[model samples]
Target: MPIPGNLLTTAMAVMPHTDPERAIQTALSLDIPFWPQLPKFDYTEDMYVQASEHFPGIVLDMTAKTLRFSMDKFLAEFEETMAHFDDPAYFDISPAYSAVYHRFLAMDHSKRKAIRGQLEGPVSFGFNIQDQDGRPILFDDTVRPFMFEFMAKRVNVQLERLKALNPNAFMFIDEPGLQFLFSAMSGYSDRAAKDDVGAFLDRIERPRGIHLCGNPDWDFLLQLDMDILSLDVYTNGEVFGSYSGSIRKFLDRGGVLVWGIVPTNMEPFSKESMDTLEARLIAIWDMLAKKGIDREWLLSRSLLSPATCCLVNPDGERTVEEAFAMIRTLSARLREHYALDGD
Candidate 1:
């Protein structure tokens, strides 16, 4: 919760790929902190979820296989709850959630301060769990409320797990599926996206953030009590061009804007360079300044990434190499240009 005293233009990287020791070193060298992501290591992984994927749990009463949670046998426990939903204390994400928390604690020393953890947002996750007819669970009113409550609980659980390691750390609500949730899904009633569901989320532990790789309903998303607004730096700038006024209000209020400048794909990743990156960043800062938003004020809340996800382009060699290199150079530039370390 160190309100980023200065501008923090840094990289958000995939932990498995980044050498643990090197990542810490790179972070300090880059003059920014690291956001560790472990998606590949676990798919139905507690933190991340493919919200649109029709997970089997919604149908057939939460079968054991459907839960498929084994990190700490969460699936087995989930099966017990499903078999006995009437039990007074049938909670979801139970012991596996507990085990994941302890596991993360052991990782504290490896990855330092402000360690980040993520979870799928309610609208997206709720809809992902499906009914037997292959319809979204969100379509079922009886199930929808439960889904939201669970999503909120799950997010809080994930935050607690991580915060038990460092209370001030951040917890990102990985709501990539929100684009569709608010745009096309049935779950999106006027109140579903904000008021009703947000009522539960308002109590979540740690600072909450949402990442949108595609365009989002900004007017609605800006409603959440979120601390950071992460956008696909490459595409969002073009996608949300007209919302400059609202964005300015958000920025002015000390809310961090994660400008995902790095291309999540190849050509753009390869196409960008230090001078190009700096120009783009300064240009962006200048753009907001035009709206009467102070450059330095905006600077304090800006977070950077090479791409939303690790430069995932089939042109892997060129794209990944350039993307990683850009991280180092970008970090150095932001540090030196701003004197982040203090001479």
Candidate 2:
């Protein structure tokens, strides 16, 4: 597919609090279908926490209101099972996998052109699962490979058809945990190493990109094959420059860059304005241009918005409305700069 080479926001999946109509409307109004977040109801409803039937013997759910995993059933089921995390025969998705997919389908098919899906990156997934003692599974050699392969296959089965329907759809694996991954010590397993991380990435396919957000594990991720490199350029904008060589290589490989240009959690609505932010973006664009990375549609590729990053507590409904306002100005500037039309 000839992916549109313009700007886009992180597909902020409809959380528990967001009005479904509003979430779908937000994607439609902004012209982006890939909203990878679904923590709209409670923080614990996260994809990892909402374990599917595919991965049996692992109990990741709790009626708890926060983001902690429930260990009662898990510990009971896997008394010596932390070692089982690496055992391939033990890592089967429950018979209920279809039910989970069915639930996702209900929401994704809610409207036409609903570009709905998720992300699953090697570095992050390698870091999410834990051992029998409830530690980073990546550090446990007996299990890292099993966990990695399971996640890769699981991610594809969950998202493949979603992409088929929307074609322009996207999926993201929330791997914000990669930044903390370091080389293994004598007792720790080295799952985050470039080669180890790349192995899992090799398991997945790409066209609509995966997101690389929060903290920089750039030595590996930015260099991988992908459709976009999502960054919070507005606040953490300085991080991307840390890997100048890798980033340039990523762009040269036809990777689109999605700048998290809007403020979320940090800067509030009172301090935001399109005119002010545009000047900041112009400076960033100029910096990229100096590297011979500038393209006319670069601004479009540079998404200018934020999403309800935290859904459990809920921001204002107008939070999305505020983001749309800035994006509107951005769209106008882009249309004029590129002389684009209703093609």
lDDT of 1 by residue, 7-124 (tens): 4445554433323344344443443344343433443332434321222243221233242211133333445545654432232344332333334445543334355656667666
- What lDDT would each prediction earn against the true structure? 0.56, 0.54
In terms of TM-score, which candidate is strongest?
2
TM-score of each: 0.74, 0.76
Segments of candidate 2 deviating more than 4 angstroms: 8-10, 14-18, 40-44, 51-53, 65-116, 120-122, 125-132, 183-192, 297-304, 312-315, 338-343
Query: What are the candidates' C-alpha RMSDs?
Result: 5.9, 5.1
Model 2 Cα lDDT, one tens digit per residue, 179-217: 666644455444446566677667765654555446756
Where is the poorest 10-residue window by lDDT in model 2?
Answer: 91-100
In model 1, what is the error at residue 37, expressed in angstroms? 4.9
Pairs that collide in candidate 1 are 233-260, 262-306
Q: After superposition, how far is residue 118 of candidate 1 from its true place, in Å?
A: 0.5
